[model samples]
Target chain A: MPKNILSVENLNGGYEVFVGRRRVFVHAVDDVTFSLHNNEVLGVAGESGCGKSTLAKMIYGAIIPPLLVKGGSISITTKGGEVLNINKLSIDEVRRKIWWIEISYIPQNSMNVLNPLKRIKDQFIDVFRYHGIKMDKTETVEHLRDTLTTLGLPPEVINAYPHQLSGGMRQRVVIALSLVFNPRIILADEPTTAVDVVTQRTILSLLKEWRENNKSSLVLISHDMSVHAYMDDRIAIMYAGNVVELGSSLDIFKEPLHPYTRALIESLIRKGDKSIRKGLAGQPPDLINPPPGCRFHPRCPYVMNICRSEEPVTTFLDNDRYVRCWLYTSSR
Target chain B: MENENMLKIESVTKLYGYGILGLKKFKALDSVSMNVNLERPKIAVLAGETGSGKTTLLRIIMGIVKPEIGRVLYRGYDIHKLKGSTARWYRKEVQPIFQDPYEAFNPLRRVDSYFYDTVTNICGIKDKDEIMYRIDESLRFVGLSLDRVSGKYPHEFSGGELQRISIARALLTTPRILLADEPVSMLDATLRVGILNILKDLKEKLNMIIIYVTHDLSTAYYVGDDISVMYRGTLVEHGPISKVYQEPRHPYTSALLNSVLEPDPSLRDKYPAVKPSSLELKEFLIAGCRYANRCPYAKEICWTTLPPYIDVDGVNVRCWKHLDYKL
Candidate 1:
């Protein structure tokens, strides 16, 4: 049931952002669709100009120019089935064979990806010699000291230096240099947003132990629904750049069919539930010309009036939940 | 809320350079002290994490940094012993909200001219219909409106409406206290509780007292009633946010309330993880218990001294393993 490793479909991007001479556009990623399965994690969530790091920089190929990709398609697949597209490749074949071999991001500042005068094993051999890979520097420092002692890290943090580590050891050396090339899908935008709750639960249990030891597929953005309830297994959501909901992380934390994911899972922080959480009243809708028909219909609290003029659709909802809202189009 | 003694701050200490002619120092607030009860309207949360002096104790309670040896005292008046219109009336009764409402105002100015320059320099309002009726009553007490933020421009608002117009320009100087350093930590967990319900409705409709420097222990236990926490520059735990977050008794507040990440994916692998040490600025200039090297219950006299604040029942808690749960 696993293999869907990164899909996407009707995604669209935006941001020509001029403002003075007036070239606006903003749509930061509307009509978004979601996928990613293989060792599945998904998450995303929303708020804060709801682009979710412009849909994790258009699913990690890290798009450029005032951010382009005006329409759909992403694909990825790989594990040798090799579907690929990734917004029609080439930024040196998406940084030589899909950035870190089939997707590997992790951004959200670990001092903007290490290199403060190198030496966390030379930034893991400058990303394993920019993928050409060759080895024998004492077997690549004993496989980066056995992958930083299988992620519990401290192999003397590979001779320190990126400002001698801390901000959770340079986010565990940028998740052990985005696992040199064991990639398949990692994304992770707000990668435990500026570390601390125990280094955001040890960098989300080292990306759920490197996606259960390389089965891969993670994604995970964050606006913290308890860091997507401790690292997703399917969650999506977004707003003002669409994707009102998607499901399973035990059905969006036990049935949240979008009223902004039930006020963002009732504004979380539940540990022995004392209640009164509330929050979501407004603000998270300006993707410029946004509010025109369900860009979370003017801060949807079950708005109605055909959710301020149509555009609802998505609804699947059974085991693999989907929900787009007008109360899941009147429960289909 | 200033029936005198609005801020006391004694023994502050802010060190920067020293040692090798520059005699090296970086204490960033060590001899810390507190007191703000101007007839109780409090909200003191300088909770830590980011070199934990909590934005250098909110830039030393907003006189914008200066604490070599303490005493801030705003109403019992000592902000480094004011001069010239009493330090501009102690900077208009101490008001600051900065934690980036997109760089807290002046994106080519006009988020209502800092609400008509705090209604003409802290409510002296030289009429323009009483500075547009006190900037439409402090932007309708921060649910915002002055023609939905009139003449807007901190990039036309929305970082939760430019932090509710920077907390309605620090509540147009009816400011008894509102330091708010981490003001909704770069907002957006659903517009961070609409700026934490407009600072818990301006501390219950303007009795006003809010220090709220945060790291977000669930919106500081849903809009704090008092919490101190701060570490690496001391005040390891304060009181009453329902007894320092439900009886914490500091093992760094029970490892920061068991490293709060519960959105419940079946409590994903139960949380213990918290490495953070990579040591060396002489281990945060240790003089015993700077969280005793990630304390699990470190007792070699908790690394040599400084424990004592043990109240326990009324909950002050500094921790020598709760000094035998002292009664």
Candidate 2:
């Protein structure tokens, strides 16, 4: 069995936005638990409002204003066999030790995060400098060049501004920025979403190579099911701030247990497919006032009485397959 | 040929900085020519990558941008040179649904007001009863209603709902050709199918020709009757959607179809690794074939001059590789 890299327990968090004067908590991620293991890509798949992005932000400890970390314990196993709950640590401590060194986050629109005015080389250097680690300038340049070349990008991009490069190039540069430290864990939130199909393939393959070489666990969040199928080793389906299903990639895709998972898989239309595929006949739930009991019950075709009134417990099937559905339960 | 009710884009070429000063120059859209028969309704997908000139072509079709070389003829009339009444008629004949629904609407104004304004202004409907009726009919076509969007602002609705409202607004004019510019790209994958279904319905039920613009081939295959594949501001290949998807004539088209990751995990074929270049800006500025830099079967002629559209099994392919075979 592979060793656990990070374990999240009962994680609950949301954004608190003001509604005319009263503050309301939009439950983005709630009561989610999962363990990410060594050197596996765990895909988080769901619709736009399903809180997968929130889960990524929460896991990164990016607790900015309006986004409140209500409760959760994120425990990480350090290299020296030390178990530390980084969530409880100060922002400064996490920034100094946890970020870039241990974990890296690649956002969807990385161009927004990167300084538009600064050259790409300066951005790469700023991350190293932020950790207060003094390295020789030539060595840092060499390291940056190596990372870029490894990702199939030319090293001359270091001299160009963010706006000068195209969308796909910028996405690769962002991934390169995150890989500077060769972090043991990477959280990539739709890194290839905005790029074209050709570029998407290149970016994802490069990402796979990076993961393989570094032996790192990657958490990829994408709304497209095909992307998850192409990249993920394990899959987790989130709906209305809760993970409705989790399992190995082979088992999950071979036989999707959850009704929502089934619908999502069925909804995809391939290039040569002639049959008519129906979109799910409902909207993604509003997290602010989500449906009670099972969040997916409203849309679930096989909904039961128990599914409406009582929240279904996570049933652990053989081979670590997890499902949250009344139909899967023995009692039902 | 002149009497047929069809859209004739006669060798349209649009270039940036053509008559401008001190601006970096490139062709926004190359010589793109195609015919859309308006006798019957169908969904024609303008499919391509980002910066592939799909949006620029749509903008040119809508008269938002003028072609530097050729003209767009709709129903045997030059669209760009129409007179007052003909232009007003042209306005009523063509309508566009932009990519971003949130940007299409004014956040400060109520959503229904725009519907009313479209019906009143462009549609030229004066009576309040007639305006409401037209708005309700169009809204119902998109699985929405006047009541649902009566008092809602742009921010009050979901992306899907706002997109539906925008579609409803476009339908109020009863456009013969509905231009959708990447309508589903901003939408979630699950919800985008619903919008695609709406486009299909428009073709089937209302008998409207929809020029559906998108980068996703799957959804394009799902909705399109015909597909025009573009690469880097040039139309690379075009044919019936199913045929083009099955056996892509152009190399770029084949590469595009190859790259789409199928949802079934068991069918995860090893995707071909493409080495990306640092400077893709040269693609736009290249005089010959724009995809010549990446195309596998490029010859000497491909670099010096652009190839004419060669007919291959009813598909028009813009590649020098097919020239010898076609001849």
Identify the candidate with maximal DockQ.
Answer: 2
Instruction: Encode model 2's per-residue lDDT on A163-227: one tens digit a residue.
Output: 87888888888899898887989999988878778888888888988899889999999998888
Question: lDDT for each of the candidates?
Answer: 0.76, 0.86
Q: Please give the C-alpha DockQ score of model 2.
A: 0.70
Candidate 2 scores an fnat of 0.70
How many residue pairs clash in all the candidates, one count each?
A: 7, 0
lDDT of 1: 0.76
User: Model 2, B64: alpha-carbon shift in Å?
Assistant: 0.7
Per-candidate Cα RMSD to the true structure, in Å, reads 20.8, 1.9
| Predictions' DockQ, in order | 0.21, 0.70
lDDT of 1 at B138: 83
- Give the TM-score of each candidate: 0.36, 0.97
Task: Give the CAPRI rating of model 1.
Answer: incorrect
Model 1, A38-86: lDDT tens per residue?
7778888887777888888888766887888888898887768868887
